[model samples]
Target: MQRFAITHAALFTVDPQDRVIPDGTVLVEDGRIVAVGPAESIEIPADTVVIDSGGKRAVLPGLVDAHSHSSLMRGVTENMPLMEWLPYYQLEHRALTEEDAYHSARLCYLEALKGGTTCVMDMFRFMDRCADAAGELGLRVNLAPYVADQPGKDFFSTREENKRLIRTHHGSQSGRIQVWMGLEHLFYCSEDAYRDAVRCQQDYGVRIHTHACEQREEEDAVLKHFGRRSIGMLDHYGLLGEKTLLAHCVWLDDDEIKRLADTGTSIAHCPISNAKLASGVARTPDMLAAGINLGLGTDGPVCNNSLDLFEEMKFASLIQKATRLDARALPADQVLRMATIGGAKALGLDGEIGSIEIGKKADLVMLDLGAPNLTPHEVTHAGGNLLWNLVFAARGSNVTHVWVDGRCLIEEGRSTQVDEGHVVATAQTCGLSLYERCRALDHLRVDMI
Candidate 1:
């Protein structure tokens, strides 16, 4: 077993009690945390490699992006709502080759690692290639193939493809890559597709991920088609459960919120995407109060434009406060929890990887505080101010190192497994090609509109 020791750093466990241990030391053995406590208290074994944090960096559990679409369509669908955005994104997605999908996955993982995100639940096309890219890059990924069984040629994967991906990639990459049942929308899928999706979940014993109540049009469409709201429609179809990670609940009503809480469903609240697309803010604060498990997500590259959870955290807090007109709406500590432990709970990986506890997976990230943005650091409230500075001001550039499963995937802000230059170039080429296709489609749509 490989033994490593990270010493002399401030630790933010983000546990239920939110423990912050200054002058901390963490011991890792065989990709699991063996001990976490003050430096003077934890014993150092003889063969352990020591990484001296020098008390200048804050060590925290790595962030989890509960929802993401690893597409090459960043900045392509700006100023469009969900209905228009969906078709536009579909046009872009239909142009993605297997190589393009791989590049997009690489780009997503690189951006995620740089932003202190160690794990991501990615819903996208060409999921096998996405899983391959993630496996090569050493990132923990839950790959969900976008499933849409509608009659449109723009729709990519069918229920058949979704099941095939699950059977082939359920536990691929030595258990690092997990496959889940994905749906483009509740409306896009036929009743048979929904039944098969449910079976897919049971057959693979994996979770179901899909967009829900993202916009008013989605709610109206669900009501028009099924004579019920999205949440209620899902419940009526027997789709509500603990294993479901609904992407957006922005248009849910009070009863919908109650239904979500009662059914033990998890939510991936994409504040950045919701705000960007003019989709009303999800009642995250209300959902949390109603006992719904809420986690922060960056939605998709086309909508959110990036997979940076740090920006999501800040936006999650600020958007709620601004909408609610209360400065204490979503506090810094709460937002931090949403990024780490809350996300883990949503994904049902809370006990395994959320916090820095003994016997847990050592998925960790280090943030450098020596920069000018974090000046005047004082432990007045045992790093409360530090947490504030990190969530409110810090960016991906402040992330120094990232470790997943006790293995260092990123060191000195660089991915160890892949060439960053090559990955960026490939993604850029794919993005440009997709953009041109989208532009052509837009011109064709102008006549129809």
Candidate 2:
């Protein structure tokens, strides 16, 4: 087993205790954290590879993206509401080939690593190809194939296909990659599909992920379909459980919030995507107060246009404050926790990978503070100020290194495993072809109208 030591750096554990160790050293042996303490206390082994951070960096647990689509549709659909956006997104999704999915996964993973996100829960079509790309790129991915079945058969996967994917890819990538049962939305799926999704989750011991209450239209559709709201309907169908991770509870009411808290369900809050789509701000402060485990997510490259969780954290904090008209809504430390420990809790990986504790996997990110935005530092309120700077000032460019399971996948602000140039070229070509196809379909729709 290989051994490595990262020494003489500032460390933010984001643990339950919220410990920040100045001039800390973390020792990793065979992909697990063996020791973490002040640099003066820990003895460096002669055979260990030492990473000298020169006290110019702040190391923290790698950021976890609790929800994402991993599609190359960044900046594609715009100025549309949920109902209109759904059909347009579907038209574009139908244009995705296996190669397109692969390249998109590569591109998304590259962006994620560069932005200091080490783990992601990605829901997309053609997930086998996505899984392959994540495996090759050494990304810690939880892959959920989009499963939707409706009466019209416009764009969705059937129940049988969802089961097949779960069987094939669960625990596939040496335990680095996991597959979950997914649905695009409750309205897009039949009652039988919902039941089968729950059954698959029980049988395979994996999580169920889906979008719920993203917009008022979604809520109205659920009410029209079942004479009840989406959360109540999901509860009636046995879909509300501890293993469920619901994305975007922006339109949910107090009753829905109570239901989620009572059922121990998790939420992936995407403030940036919500704002960009003109979706209402999620009541994250209320949800957190109600004991809901809230994690940060970028939603998708298409809607969010970037996978930077630091930006998401900043947006999450500012939006909550602005919406509530209360400055104390989401503080810097709370936002930092939401990006690290809160995300791990929502993903059900809290026991293994959230903080820099001994016996935990060494998934870490190093941010260089030598830049202009981070100078004139002060140690008093350092944790709070460090988090504020990270959320408000830092970008993907500030992330110097990223490690997952003690393996260096990103070094010096670049992906070590994937070819950035080739991935970008392929995504560009595929995106152009998709645009042309959508234009042709628009003409057909116009003629029909």
Candidate 3:
């Protein structure tokens, strides 16, 4: 059996009450946490491999990124209208081979692990290859192929492609990979496609994920096509439920919010992607008040330029405060919950991965609080809340080490599963090849990177 232990760190359990143990120890064996408590209380087991934290690190439940796309589109999709951005950005994805998809997923997992994210829900194409790459890299992932039936936007081979993907790869890799049904969007999918998606979920017992109310033109097109608002149409078509995870939900009124709440649908709020696409501010404060489950997301690498949940955390709070003209719009604790527990709940993995509870999988991140920006955060006894520092000050760079499934995938700022230089160089080479093959140089805000 395998064994691991980390001691002498500030443990933010992020449990129900947001418990923080200043001098804590966590013991693991065979991929499960055996004990977690104040350091003096928990005995170190024999033959355990101990990880040193230098007494100034904070041990947190690994950050959960609820929505992402494994794409090489960073810096190329900026400053375009949402409608224009889709074809310019996503269409070129068709040019990638299975090898390209593997490299893309590898790079995405590499960046996410470095940024302290242990779990991700990504929707894209070539999902089998992506699943294999994630399995090899040791990050827990939920993947699906983008399914749509629009005249020019069929991202999957057939309407039943996600079904095939689920049968072949879902729940594979010792449960590290879970597959879901991904609809491109309500606007892009026909009524038959939507019905089929619901049927697929019922048959396979997998969750349904898709975009909704994201683009500025999306609501108008949805109304024109379906004779109702976006959320209303989802409700009418029997698509709203606890098993549904919607990506954007940026444009919702009171009734639509009620519809979502009534159906128990979860939302993945992408603050950076909304701003980058000019998709406008979501009714986030209202959504939270309505008792909806909202989680933070980075969308895609090209759109946000980074898969840093720390960046998403800051924006998730700051945007709400600014949009509502209330300095108290979203408090520090609530935003922190959105990044951790909220994401777990959204992805329906809460029982196993969200908090630093004993009997849970050992997915954790250790951040060096001694870092410059995280300084003045010595201790809560000194009147500083590191929880707030985590939201407003911490960056992805502060992550010193990461553990997923009790395995050390990122150690001291480097990936253990991949050669960092080779991964970066390969992604760079693939990006250029994709651009050239897709003839995508015309869709740029800057002439050059």
Model 3 clashes, total count: 2
Instruction: Give the Cα-based TM-score of candidate 1 against the true structure.
Output: 0.96
Expressed as tens digits, the lDDT of each residue in 1-449 for candidate 2 is 79999998888888777888778899999999999988899998999999999888889999999999887777888887666676677766666678878888888988898899988999887888888888888878888777877755444556666677777887787677878888878767778888888888778798888888887766887788689988988898899988999999999889889989999999999998888878889999999999999999998788889999988988999999998999988988888888888888888888778789999899999988898887744433256466668777878788999999999998998888878888788888887877777766663231000
Tens-digit lDDT track of model 1 for 88-137: 66665556677778888889888998889988999888888988888877
Q: Indicate the worst ten consecutive residues by lDDT in candidate 2.
A: 440-449
Q: What is the lDDT of residue 239 in candidate 3?
A: 90
Model 2: residues with Cα > 4 Å off, grouped in runs: 380-384, 443-449
- For model 3, residues 1-449, the per-residue Cα lDDT tens digits are 99888998888888887778888899988888999988889899788898767678998899999999998767866688687677676555557677778888888989999999999999888889898889778999999688878765644445667789999998898888999988877756788887888898999899888888886587888788678878887777789999999999988988889879888999999998898889988888799899889988999797889999999999988988898889998888788888888998999998889899989999999998999899878555222478789889999999989998899988899988878999899989997787776675344322100
| Model 3 residue 422 CA deviation in Å | 1.1
Q: Is candidate 1 or candidate 3 better by TM-score?
A: 1
Stretches off by above 4 angstroms in model 3 are 155-157, 381-383, 440-449
What does the lDDT come to for candidate 3? 0.84
What are the lDDT figures for the candidates, one per model?
A: 0.84, 0.84, 0.84
